[model samples]
Target: MKSSYTVENPDYQLSPKTGMTRSHYIELAKYLLEGAFQHIDSFDDILTFPLIDGKTYPQEDSPAWRFRSLEFEALERTFTLAAPLIHNDPETEIKGINLRDYYANLLYKALTPGNPNSLPMPEDLPDSTYQYTCEFGGLFKTLLLMPDTIWSVYTEEQKAAMVKTISAWGHHRTTQNNWRIFNITTLSFLKKQGYEIDDGLLLNHLQWVVSYHSGDGWYLEQTYNYYSISLFIVYTTIWNRGFGDEYYPEISKTIEKSAQKLMESIGNFFGRDGYINMWSRSICYRTWVSGAFPVAFMLENPNLLDGGWARRLCSGSLLQFVTKEEFFVNGIPSLGFYGQKDYMVQSYSCPASPFLMFLPFICLALPEDSPFWTETENDGFWEDLGDASTQTLLPSPGLMLVNHGKTGTSEIIPGKVYYDDPNYSKLTFNTHFPWEDQNPDGGTSMEYAFRSLDPRDLRGDDINFYLTGKTVDNDSELRAKFTHSQNMLFNGQRDGVLYRQAIMRQPPNNGVGYIIDLAEITLPGGVLRVDRTRLAFEYELTLGHFGLPHIDGVEATVEERKLADRTVMIARIPGRSLAFITYHGWDQAEAMTHDGNNAEADSSTVLFARKTAPKVNPKMEILITAMLHKMDDSEWTEEELSPVKDFTIQTFAPSGSPCGVQVNLSSGASHHVDYQNIDGLRTC
Candidate 1:
């Protein structure tokens, strides 16, 4: 990868640890765009070019049209960094294309009234290209932020055309959620350029965006992931920065406060190793999460994070992805996070889509003298913080994050998630392992369900289960209650909760049926899942629990014991261990190996326990306690393992208690259940 311009500015300083400077980031942005546009003959080719090798993302009514946004993404960052610096330096051409001419050609093709290759303006009824509203937002934002370079380079005729195009898009109807930010951003830019803008339209969308804010610096965008920090918070901060306090004064304050809140909660998501959480969607837009840090720096708000920490975070996250061979293929970003894995690629992804990862370089738009470039970089949260156990409850997203700093492991127990998407609805998301997609028997931290199928047919439909609802009680500080339910049929009869049927290979005389209600309570390392099952017909039931990744070189061990009323299974690696204790409704425990269960690792293993009776009682409630912990690697007495060895769960009410079980720890601390008043339950 070669940069068009050399780093000649003395003000641009490199961070000692990350080896990243403002020039290096700018060079990266330029390199990515140059690679993307290398073969393009005209600006129109951006929409029609086939950048991806293996797959062709046609521009029909398919979801692939959204990939065109990638070109705009690359241009947005390239121009954002180039516009401010080009006027000061004469040799500013990137890959033989002058900044001014390149942007003008793009703008002319996108906004020219009768040009054959011009972009489609807003239409009353959205077509295949309607999703480009976000791209338009990016375009307008680039023009607004770099007015001297973008606006000054355009002829009066071209400026009129651009304004006309933006006016139509500003008033155009868009999706009510995050898409509303498109219109808000576009109109804000138009107003800055002296266009007569409708305040009502701006305020409506502005208020609509504000409505999605879920306090403590989080916003609900399809269930809160990186977008809460990257897009929502960054957009509002840009709005406030573009149109100072003179307009929407109160809203400016709200944006600042939200940015501050996000800053406070941001450290928990980034690992000490600088890897961002891989739990959510758009994993290819890798370093965009660092966009929030730049916003905090631009706002001069130390409360969000200091310059040194921001540099460390932004540079660390950028390097974490860029330094990997799997991140880029043929100098273009691949679809997967670390490699080309089809499981992580969503329907809307295209080859150019990964360039959106350049969003963090928006910080490069800041001047060289800004603290972001000049500050002495510090070791990020991972290195600065000591060994500690930290748990934070984010109410807006209904997520409880437990960070075991010493072991460099973190677990997120999500309280509310979109039912249709299992990525967010899993029992727990661990930072060390990527969630398995479409594999019910794999990647799940804990799965509780009834498997009624032939022993030989592992592919048989094993109706999966998920966390339906969760609530935290006002009285309980450490305890949160959750409800799990699944809908199935019984004897060909449709019922919401009961499933009664004969196994496919079994005789009609051996038919079985059951009605099940499940719930869970959180613990330090794992969750205690309680399933109350009522046998409508006699059949076999099995429950499985998967522990953390067991790498190839690591020493792995599994142990099982059968007590009078419970079956216990424990799996241990070097510094961590997982124990599954089934108190009732289980007869035997066994160890199982899973092939191709991990995205990063080669193979994995799990522990499963089956209830004792082939003919279970008509109505039975089962309690299974799962404990995951980072074991103390330091040599110590037997007393050290006592807490884990002596862990016990006492069920108070099989199906009703708010706190479903009284969990006794080896440390002599006991957790009581009170199921009546639960907290944190919000309808998705």
Candidate 2:
């Protein structure tokens, strides 16, 4: 029963340690080099054609060429010039050294001295091409950091020129994800090369990064499903090198702690089938969860208690990804889950973006003696327990997950869009100013984050899943308290946090409610509850992607279904319906009727009303129902209940010491739920 119903995976040929016998590290290295060579002259071609004559360049051809030629050329030069340094001199002396430099030299000669069409361009280009250029910069930075190379064959003046070129362009840009990552990475490269740049400007850039930390390991991906954890882990790693445990030890420690929190997030994110929630913008940049490798590898200190466990937690997910061929597209890694079609790309991703997955190769950078390089793979977070595995429920947040066999969770379908845009997956909610809930209290706001952790792996004990989440509170220190039967833990810090826990699925037909209550929280002026629903949209529509309806003259209905000690209020309409109730300030937000038809309307449950039924005079009927409750400036509590659980309660939370968590469950009797098979997906 467990084998058939459990979320287990089939092995693939990728990882060296498990599944497929292929050496993926070597394949990935070839892929990265091929990507660099394949696009060597792409910028040059883009610069030669402007498309201003009103010619529509197919996606294979970028028309923004004329406007961004110089920027592209500079970026290309960054990569072209750094390639030679990858294999030679000191680096080649190290173990496992190989160099592929012909493409690098060809690309370098083509872009150096700066193509007139492509020099001195704004570090910021059209939104359409910015990510491509930045990624070019990232690749170049990675090449520069390689331990050896032919770069030393160049005169001092030439190497300095390269450093100056990178510094100038990287410093001028300013966007959260791009700038923060670019700055830290570039700064690390510069410091390594022994070049001097302004300390104040560099630190200021770091400070700006510090400001974006949202306490619980969240950094705004920006405007939409901005991925915070992946970006932060990478940026913090670069920053860690530059800081050297000096000025910002606390901040560094906080980031390390937050990285653990991020692992907890990844642990809950994957389902038993090795599936991951594909909810953010760079769906094409799918292997992003693996990007956390550098951060995890950095926490070598066992004294930090959870530090060692955190590394293993994150490494386990990475191992899960590489076991499958899902991480690559046409031999080159794609942007994410849906490949370039992923909604998060928003034109930011280019052919160069997925190479960022090489960010995980930072693991290779671990010295030969490092533990991560030698640790053996296990069943990971999904280890089998004595009886039935763990399960968790989050009702108000609209998420029901079950962890089978091990402490990890699972999802029936992985990477299915929870909203139209991957960005919407981070549903930061508020209770005040309903109309401005996402931006409550003017600028201060709250948001939720979800990530699918199944990297490209072929392991059988994989976790497959889709995660839907919402922020009930924007402030720090929100907690989900349960019995010793099971628990959820919380830890809040000034510079992000490390909150980790396992979420299990509730038993079938058990009306168990996992309440995620928020205290010291405020809602937007026009909102009642921020309900998040994950949907798979076959079309590309951006309007009302958050599940809010925009249909004019649409009517609504509301009803109250009572359970043992709770009342479940349901709002509906024929077929599919969406309801948006405005607070007008809580008291004023209520069920208002202006009817031409007669329908049963309950006071306790607000619903959109109509004269008759939609079957009769559907045209004249437009009823809206909203429930209201009043509260003054005093301590307040809000609770959401599930339909009901016949006879079981479960709780799980991260344990403080041996660095993990304790799982507790009470199911009345010994009969356990058994079923197996997990689900996972790969983008072809």
lDDT of 2: 0.35
Q: Name the best candidate (by lDDT).
A: 1
| TM-score top scorer | 1
Local accuracy by lDDT, each model: 0.57, 0.35
Summarize candidate 2's per-residue lDDT along 400-513 as a digit string, tens digits.
Answer: 233434213342111112222223322221111011112111111112111111121112121222232322322121111111101222211111111212111122211122
lDDT score, candidate 2, position 132 = 31
Which 10 consecutive positions of candidate 2 have the poorest summed lDDT? 675-684
TM-score of predicted structure 1: 0.76
**For each candidate, what TM-score against the reference?**
0.76, 0.50
Q: What local lDDT does model 1 show for residue 513?
A: 38
Candidate 1 Cα lDDT to native = 0.57
